[model samples]
Target: MPASPHPDPFTGWLRDHAAPLTHLDPEAPLDDLEPLRDLIGDARVVAIGEHSHFIDEFIRLRRRLLRFLVERCGLTVLAFEYGFSEGFPLDAWAQGQGTDDDLEGHLGETVPVGVDDPLRWIRRHNAAATRPVRFAGIDIPAAGGSLLPALTPVADYLRDIDPETLPAIEQAMRIAASFAGTSAASAAPAWARLPAADQDALTAALTRLLIRFRAVEPLYVSRGDRRDYDLALRRLEGACQADYGFRAMAGLFAGNGLTADTSARDVYMAESVLWHLERSGPGSRIVLAAHNAHIQKAPIRPARTQVPGPDRIRLQSTFLHTPGLDAFDGILHTPAATVARDLEEGKTP
Candidate 1:
């Protein structure tokens, strides 16, 4: 019954290097990586995601950080969480053309971005970096509820594991479930495995858990169906399977009208690391904007340390009480006007 030997490589390093690395704090005001300057030279990349209550805070923080990227870091692309059903012209979109309005209203009527927005801001800064930031939603299939059960493979795997690893794994699965519900229908089998009787039990348990997490805002739940719970777990796992790091913010569920105990923020930082490794170089540069929770440091052990499969990307992310709006080489929060419209239309609250 001795505590499990530290099963994670990064965890060991983090514990050993516990003295706050003078450079890790994202909010530091250095225009350059003066402390860990050599670690993230021109080739390295920095990705940040945010969940904020104020739209102005989101917009101002995001824009300032992004402006820094253009002036200091050779930032290349600006990606978004939502996409369009029909792919539109990136040039026109970037130029603030007719498509500037959000046709779907998922983000808002003014489109989550605008010509004067960060998208255009980055373009104005590095017009030559015009890679025509790809609109990937069109390529991704429309989401359906049928895929909820497809998450069982992961849940069953967690169910058979020990307690120490179970929470991290379960949390990861929840993050994956959230996204799986939005992706293709191939994820159904995994969801089918959760005991129908325990579904409510699990949801109720998670609802209590969420009560403590929603303070930072941006995380929410629309409904309390066991199926959505199943899907949320699967989405976390799916994102992890795809190499994205997952992190959950507590209490996000209750604020959005779902079980507070079970709400979380799904994240993928390792993917950003890998993506940065691939895209950054001496001359080329990239900047990413995402939730503050995604980049916060944690004491997480590797997924493979206790479970099977190659070491699933693991990181114990520190829960940030506030979003990292100004910490990036460049940053942009989702605009409030757009978020308001989505809430009004009942698309998302």
Candidate 2:
């Protein structure tokens, strides 16, 4: 037989460089993921990316990967692309402090796509594990289509810690309450319709609330528990981002310019992740679960750069650039192929 002229270029390249994925059994998922420890090395944060949220196979694969990271690699935190304000209940459920029903109820309108199975698994895992893994949500508190849920908590915290600041806190709460009637789709228009004075007052009130909290840090910390202090801070951060997001939306509608709203949300999510890392202290590893677009370390262009559309916003590029953080874009050819094969075989990957 005559020798073949050459191997196909793409197949030859893949054969030389690509690492093949191990088929994962649903009954024994982590058995196949042991090799990933070497691949992950000593990186503190392993960000697993997904191409889409609605895929059952992707969700199952992520759940298995999360189990591997937690059990084998000693990862202590599993952060999600969920609202920070709404994370407490979910965290409680994961830590075995709340019931599954409680978590589902608290998740309310902002549940992530294909989260049902994973949620049940996490609850069971936490209940059985000696040292339960913690959960952290890294998005702004817009899960309920409004920032009220986040802002209300801050106001209540202030009222408890420093009654003297209640007036200022209430002012901020009122501004946030104005958003209750607005849907996520109409937030920008509603914000744009507000009087300039109201807008300025809302901004000033939130700013002052943050400043006041900072100024009384010692008192707040001493009087309240650490969790309370942390919640207050998270609420403040969410409120500030809410304001920025509204402005960004307005800009998007008016064709003013590329607003920082999307960027700000990603930055806040990154900050939330870092905060969890800090709280967990040294020797802590985090398994961050977000969309591929939000986790990739490379510069990401807006989907439609040439056109004036919402897709043009480069959201998570800033977050990916955080120093000392290592990221892996898991939506690659090899693992995706593995997932496809598993789905075809009627097995969860």
Candidate 3:
């Protein structure tokens, strides 16, 4: 018999369960987004992912979802895939301390920014908020454009808290100056050309700085505010991750593939989210915005690993892996974008 035209049970089930999005305006009333509440029950984070970045529709939908989660679910922070060390100034701008251009400039300084709408929306909301939605960056500094985003803050902190330790951070800075470039893709190749001695030295310098931060935590805390000290230490941690990530990426050029068992950015980003959540105190929920691939639970296989690496490395997915879903608690799937972007068709953005 000829097959019926009806879709299979799986397709029908998805259609039945899916919540229809009524509007993409962030300022829209929250009633339509109520269907998501049941899915988000008791979840501490509601991570919304887009199929592509910088798309107008996805950006607006993301903004809408963010508003819903904040107003309806009481989520208080935006843990974005920006640089963890660079979040402070951006956060300050989100609280209305700077002009729009100042906020835009700060956004560019921290990472490769595409839009400022999200921060603008958050700022407007914060204007009269008692518990304002906070901004949090959970990625490596400058998106691996340069190591200074991570290092410069640490240097300043050390200068204030322990001037004697400036040499350690300064050495790391000098080494980074040689190889760090405009982005991870650029930095990795530059790092590969550096002597292995320089590679190892940067790592060692970061380690030494970390050790100093811990060994004198009490003294540092007394010298500076505990909050400031903690942030500085975290910035130091960001530097360590950035250095390791650059080397691991360089492995691909060395015929070693990326030696890191996992994407270093995702590892640090996940930790940064947890770190902020913990510090935000209990009962605080966060709205995490990032690419679809960065939020999945499935393991990501290493790509084209070279000598001294497994053919199929089974590690968690990252921004470096294939796009995956991040709608654990809730999802906002926009229609296929009408406009074409340069990054499409296998072009790396």
Candidate 4:
């Protein structure tokens, strides 16, 4: 059958550009990846994305590439799609401040816990390196339901620096606490049950808390340390964004656009990455680990006839054009059968 004439011209084109990576030893040092240095020359943030989680091959490939980035490329940070608040402890553990058990307990709370090998590799690498590589979580800390976890650090910082702002923080915490549950499914109903007046009040309080945090930044920095203040501020920002996202989810049935919520989350995640870059100083390279959908340099388009109408909302690209950042889709290839099936069905593979 001559392989059915190679199916399409793009297959030939891909063959021309694609190198056989299967020959590379999974346990070997990634000297073969040295060619990537030219392509990634001096980019501060290089995002490597996977199609799905929990696949051993994908995890191993990413781990090898990340080791190359860390050892050969001088990459200093490895940021995950996990929440910023939850990542702190992991980061601390990575930097050799905590025990392996502590790190395992923290990872148990996040999605990456399912794939333990790569994370264990990172922890070991960090422990042995003279200049430890840091771990960062860039998403909102609401994976376990409620945005309340993101607010704790901010509230604690406020208690020490500006006690007066505690009331607003407490109010936001109360609102978040009202929706406490194991998953979004269980918590969303609680959020939906809240009166519009209470929702508005919670939003107002959160907004006010942010404003107060910014207004008192100089004083707070002077009273404590600048790093602590900045950390607290980031946590508060995550809390605010998570709250907004949850509110949008609650309104999903009401025709309130969800794209904006998704865009906001991605932007917040990008901002968190940038924040780490700024803190790390110049010439610091970061390896960002995220789902391909969240890191791709393509615009998210809504379906024409989708609910709430595309015109009423705005969509944006994820991390394609951030200054000094390079986005790479790390998915090697789809199974040939899957691609053929998708093509026959007129669907995207």
Candidate 5:
């Protein structure tokens, strides 16, 4: 008889499962899934992102985590920076209050890209769960400013406004300028892009445009309607790169405006953890999906202490180094040697 392929593959291997996973180098390298596996075993709140090999690892780990929660912890929530943050009304779908068809209509209006990414997979999984996942969001508004026309209506609002009022119209001109400056870069294809000079020109123009908006200090007053703002902020909260960028900018503007709804988004990451645990029983488990930046230690020292508590959340963040990206925690350093070899051997994809 052959052996069964079980969750933990280490049973028949060497005595210690830790040897393969740990890296001695000060900068942790992700060689395999051991560290992440260990983290999932004990953690009540686990956050991770969309790393290359990580997606498969997460699917496996989620299965384990879900089983553990249903059998032992009584979990009732799978908090996502994706659905709840974007106001997908996943809980409504889970409880038979609505159908995927109902939620599908709102997905385009809510999420930045169409919701065909990993987040949709998570939502579908949660929908099949025995207990419905509760809904919670950052409850903040979109940031002020005018974005370029190429962007959606929501983005136009975030690019050019000040702290007080929702300055939608005035921002249009600024967004136009920003886009005009980067028109060439926009035309370049990712596989075989244009010259670096064109890209640099666009980048510089964008920086200048955003900087000009900051200098002006415009006030964005809300019209007593938070529906769009809340929907936008919640969806923005779970995003990486552009989504996080927009969300943080919005949060800063809201803070400056002293808006009550805006204040809710400042602690959005923490609130997500607490909200999940609360929905579950006395000892519920949760798994969060977010980017490396959202999980990184806050610049303020005291804020780092908020990682492990009943209300605290834990994160497993990963990222690749690029020209414009630095100052991120939980980095998995890719040595120059490997990258050079990949490029030299024509294995660079």
Candidate 6:
């Protein structure tokens, strides 16, 4: 009705490109979402990004968009910003393996928000379907919670196929225990406090595991399924990444560094999404549900944020900006955009 209602030029562009979501209900007919079909033309991953998490409107919009993508666009995999290693059970839940009660417990502790409904719906949708829908967690184990989620799995794999390597994994686990007692982001500081030798030892242990895994891929594959070996390798990679990222942030905390590291978590996430693509085979589509900062190619300015340790940080979603590789071809936004009434009033909530 009103031309470019917001004074910002970007809002005008957004209004021009975005088709306002009609209803928040996933069960509702998706005729209103038809406009997105062209906007999302031939994209492999349709990343639905929210400016903030735990917002009711954005969360509902994600649900509706996910349903539409899976049902209409033939996107079989719904990758999330949750823990990669801890996501196995959640993925199983999507495949109808667990009851709602079981899923409730997992999602409560595992994913922060917005993933439960999609997983529940996937479970129902896969009930009678032959191919069935899929779920993938692209984040480090437990969403930056702990290294154990990934490390423990790697250790288990080594225990089964290459027992000689157990000591290395065990060593890494021993150092991880100082901070990774639980799946919480609080471990970075504790990890920072670990002796420099212990920290370097953890890296060394993981390096040994990686070299061992690569050295005997065929042997390990023969002992275990190829898929299992590959997944284990990738999961170990996640643990290594967690160590790298946490250590960098810890250094920033301990040293007051100005910039973020190589953006290890986001790089892992981009690779994880690609791994899903390879597994799904060519021409398959995936729907990635994550924060706007992680999905948007343009950087998000940290405005009025109390986040410490850096004047600026390396952005997410940029790794997905690989040349000729389009991570998210389309993005759909909802109506609600503001944070809170208090935030608008310049008062911290």
Winner by TM-score = 3
The per-residue C-alpha lDDT of model 5 at residue 59 equals 38
- Alpha-carbon local distance difference test for all models: 0.36, 0.68, 0.74, 0.69, 0.38, 0.74
Per-candidate TM-scores read 0.36, 0.77, 0.83, 0.80, 0.38, 0.81
- Residue 314: error of model 5 in Å? 19
TM-score of 2: 0.77
Where in model 4 is the C-alpha error above 4 Å? 2-7, 23-26, 29-35, 113-116, 181-186, 302-331, 334-349
**Winner of 4 and 6 under lDDT:** 6
For 240-282, candidate 4 gives per-residue lDDT tens digits of 7877776777667678666556467788899999999898866
Off by over 4 Å in 3: 1-7, 109-115, 253-255, 258-260, 301-331, 338-349
Q: Tens-digit lDDT track for model 1 on 177-236?
A: 544543222333333344554433444434433332232112223333343443334333
RMSD of 6: 6.9
* Candidate 2 vs candidate 4, lDDT winner: 4
Per-residue lDDT of model 6, residues 1-349, tens digit only:
7766547654455567656666877688988989888977888888887656656677777888888887888888989988777778788888878676788787654434567778888888899876788898888876666788888878888888999888888989988877773443467767777888999999999888888888889999999999999999999988888888876787575676546473778889989999888997666888998765566664434333222211222222232222111223455545465343433444321
Instruction: Locate the minimum summed-lDDT window of 10 residues in model 4.
Output: 306-315
Give the better candidate number (1 or 5) by lDDT: 5
TM-score pick, better of 3 and 4: 3
Query: How do the residues 125-217 of candidate 5 rate in per-residue lDDT, one tens digit apiece?
Result: 566766544443322221111122222333544543332323432343343334232111231122013345533443444444344433442
* TM-score, cand. 5: 0.38
Cα misplacement distance, residue 137 of candidate 3 (Å): 1.0
Output the worst ten-in-a-row residue range by lDDT, candidate 2.
305-314
Q: Which tens-of-lDDT digit does each residue in 1-349 have in candidate 3?
A: 8877974654565576677877777777878888888888878987876655656677777778888888778899998878888787889999989687787567553323333677888898999998988899888876776788888978887887889988888998998898776577677788777898988888898998888789988988899898999888888888888877776666655677654533777888889999999998768899888776568655554433221211221132323442122223334566665432424533343
Show where candidate 1 strays beyond 4 Å. Answer: 1-43, 49-54, 79-116, 120-269, 272-284, 300-348
lDDT of 6 at 91: 88
Query: Clashing residue pairs in candidate 6, if any?
Result: 145-184
